[model samples]
Target chain A: MNEAITTISVAAGDSVETLFRAHYARLVRALAVVAGSQEAAADAVQEAFVKAHLHWRRIQRYDDPVGWIRRVAINKLRDDHRRGGRKERAVERLKADARPDQIEWSNGQDVTALLAELPRQQRLAMALFYVEGLPIVEVAAAMKLSEGAVKFHLHQGRDRLRGVVAISQEQLP
Target chain B: MSEFDDDRMERLLGAAGGAFPDVNTAYAQVQGRVRHIKQRRSMIAGTAACAVLVVGGAFALGSTGQRSNLQPGDHGSLSVDASVDTQSTPATDDTSAIRPSTTTAGSGAGSNGQGTSSQPTGPSSSTAATTTPSNPATADVQTYTCAGGTITVRLAAGALELVSSQPAAGFALDTSTATATRIEFRWRSSSDDQSIRIDLIGGVPVRKV
Candidate 1:
């Protein structure tokens, strides 16, 4: 973490422009890991900033605006996926697993293709938990799921990823 | 151990995530939109002021020296009291004479047949209303545009006209003032709304007040 990050712990007196520049990159990266597409992640973060600005004066009084923004960004991501359809819902399930395979591959290299192989929910669970490093509570808030459900999705997602990646590796070697 | 518990996995995902683009430009884009919205709000405000002055000048000239008998709900009318803070600079209208499309409302006159014949027709049904100029925003016409739509207002002829530039997805209007009449038209796809004001200055539209 950069020295500037410690300042994020307490959100007082920071100009919107300054806070935006400092955390924008990290937030995008975090969202991209769960969003599956760079463009979607960027959009989600952008929306978060807008919402943050709307409530900036009041939010500056909080202990951590970054966390508040992240929580909001994650929720936005979940809402977008929900609006997309059943397939998207499944991917969100996978992203909760906190597993790396659930999130890697947006270089247009075959990440999406690989991800397509897992149940959407499992894939989403893995991506959010492992790639984004968000706690289950935060993930639940972002995913709009109960903690028990997130746990279930993560557990099921890890098993599924283990199965798929193992089979693929065996076939490769 | 998890299948993803490997350094290679972290490196690959980390690099890919790191590939995410800078959000400053995007943020700036939204900020630019905010600024543009502010400007449009001022313009709409200025236009609104112009409308008021134009309409008010006509009203003042038409009724020259008569005492206003405006009472509460005398003819099913409502009142609008606007209070604008001076902290935000008020908008002024540069174009005073050119009003947007004003259409005549052909509502029937009362049995007494006084001055109720030329009442402005709109979505509101009640008549005989007195529209006090939105001080600061003492105009009869205002215009607003956004990615979703374009709205133009002309009050002297007593109607608000709106044109959608793009198909609308949805919309909503929650104005506090109930004194002025309102008419709304919508298509099926746009959702954004911009604000512009017209101000009446010395019987001629002026720039931001």
Candidate 2:
């Protein structure tokens, strides 16, 4: 890994280095929400960006290269989950490793548990709509679902989260 | 009202994704992987070019009735093509090749079918452009709902054509050239009956070509 060199060559507005810097952390965080583990999320994003770099010569030609990167990274995380129980195992590790002092713990295991409980597309809708700050229409666009479907997922995701969080709070107090 | 409708739920959902450590090392880590993949890419490209040269030479020899070295009965293309592929990835090779492993790992990825699609054992990555054998009849088919439109590429039937795009909400797969994004480009390799098919999505090569 080289030091962050100021990219001397800029073709148009999008550069590989520029995209990486701007979205690397954001992608890691967003995918952690989807994949439920910071390490795995980072791994997926790193792998995705590596592909982006591999195809950068042509990828830079796209209208939304960063969006393409995001889609690939998210799909990688999704595929990682589909491949096996790695993310679930990671979550179990999260619960066991919770120190009550860490940010994940502060955020509440219930959040992770509930997020996992949501169906895949619904979770994706939540991640894009809330975590990544994409508007509803854009979230629909990103997920390749209809705007009605996006709204549906959002509604279902919120309804599920509310019910679960309320139950968690009652048990806490 | 939905749970997320409330401010408390909003705060929690917004904070769902946790922070990562050592943010500074991230770009470096990604860059390191990029370098590794690119090196491997160049190696594949070089090996493929060499294979083409060898195959071309053998074909030139076999055409002449007196070209004794090539087996008179067996076509030169098949034998040479097999040899070329066999050299790239040994069946015993570990799954450490990250680019192919990453590109072909899941059921759905936009492109890079060019390299490391070990299942069919055809050429991959940039080498796909040059390594189309003529004898392959198998069709690799897949349907993906990308961005706005549904993109499907069915290979071997004919020319690279868009199967269907309804509402065509987003992304376009144009086979006119290699630089097309949101479009899947299918290239048929020109080695007689043995051909390689490559699918590129958003300018990234997908499963095979």
Candidate 3:
């Protein structure tokens, strides 16, 4: 009985640690695109993981624990934005640090700047769908929105980016 | 539009993500943060338990003192009643001898009531006075001299008000670091830029330059 109990405890610990190792980097990168600052996104993701660790006993029972962490991180980002000061400071740092070489796209376009032009919800949906490669259902779960709402936001975001690209093409000499 | 298809969108977003961070380092940081959070929570819980124990102990002591003090008054009142009963009895030889005893008992009872009543009232009145200043509506304004002028501070309900004698520019309160007991402020004056900290010590705001 003692050996079995020890094994179960070790398994639980390993599983949560495994989840953290698997998803931390991808979540941070995807959130950085939405948050406009790698630092802020990393902070939010770390805070979410900390909370997940504290509540792992209950959270591990969930069908998708990563979904819970994503939701928490996104909510933290939203709260930071609503608070205004920290998010503004992060965006300022992003603006100051952004260089042609630093954020240059392979296609020779500033995709980060383009995404920044999209509304917050659309930007989040687009980043999760494309950058993170999450399905609409998972994106909806993370965003706490319906699948239809996620789809609509994705469609609108695509159209907006397309229009921006076309306008830039028209202006080219 | 055709060029901006799903594949292109994916590639653009993927490229924009730059480089993936080191998972091991991030995991280490997360573990550190978790440990910090747990430490803070435990400290808070410990402090709260200590506070409860202190308050509970004080309350228990206060009640015990009150009961002990009231016992004398109760016995005094009973003795006074007994004295009255003795005085009302017929003036026989035995009653005459008990008259002096009854009078002494009555006077002792009067003094006990006076002493106990005075003892409880003194602390009660002081307690009331001490708590009155803690109420924001009744709080007094505190002033401190700065480089150029004096800043008067008033504590309101969940807010702090500052009034400067001289015109100061860039007066800003750093609410981000505001706590129940301390708040920081910064402002620019003709002399130079100044910063001040206000600490709520014993329910009174004290200015620290």
Best by TM-score: 3
Segments of candidate 1 deviating more than 4 angstroms: A1-8, A62-64, A75-109, A116-124, A144-146, B1-18, B23-27, B44-209
Candidate 2 runs further than 4 Å off: A1-11, A91-105, A108-110, B1-7, B65-209
TM-score (chain A only) for the predictions, listed in order: 0.65, 0.78, 0.79
By lDDT, rank the candidates, best first: 3, 2, 1
Rate residue B10 of model 2 by lDDT. Answer: 42
Model 3: runs farther than 4 Å from truth? Answer: A1-14, A89-104, A107-109, A167-173, B1-5, B71-209
lDDT of 3: 0.59
Residue A155, candidate 3: how far off, in angstroms?
Answer: 1.0
Who is ahead in DockQ, 1 or 2?
2
* Candidate 1 overall lDDT versus native: 0.48
lDDT, residue B105, model 3: 14
TM-score of each: 0.46, 0.53, 0.56
Evaluate chain B of model 1: give its TM-score. 0.23
DockQ for every model comes to 0.16, 0.20, 0.23
List, in the given order, the native-contact fraction of each candidate.
0.32, 0.47, 0.58
Estimate the TM-score for candidate 1.
0.46
Candidate 3 positional error at B16, Å:
2.3
At residue B108, what lDDT does model 2 achieve?
Answer: 29
Q: Output the number of the DockQ-best candidate.
A: 3
Top-scoring candidate (lDDT): 3
Q: How good is the docking of model 3, by CAPRI class? A: acceptable
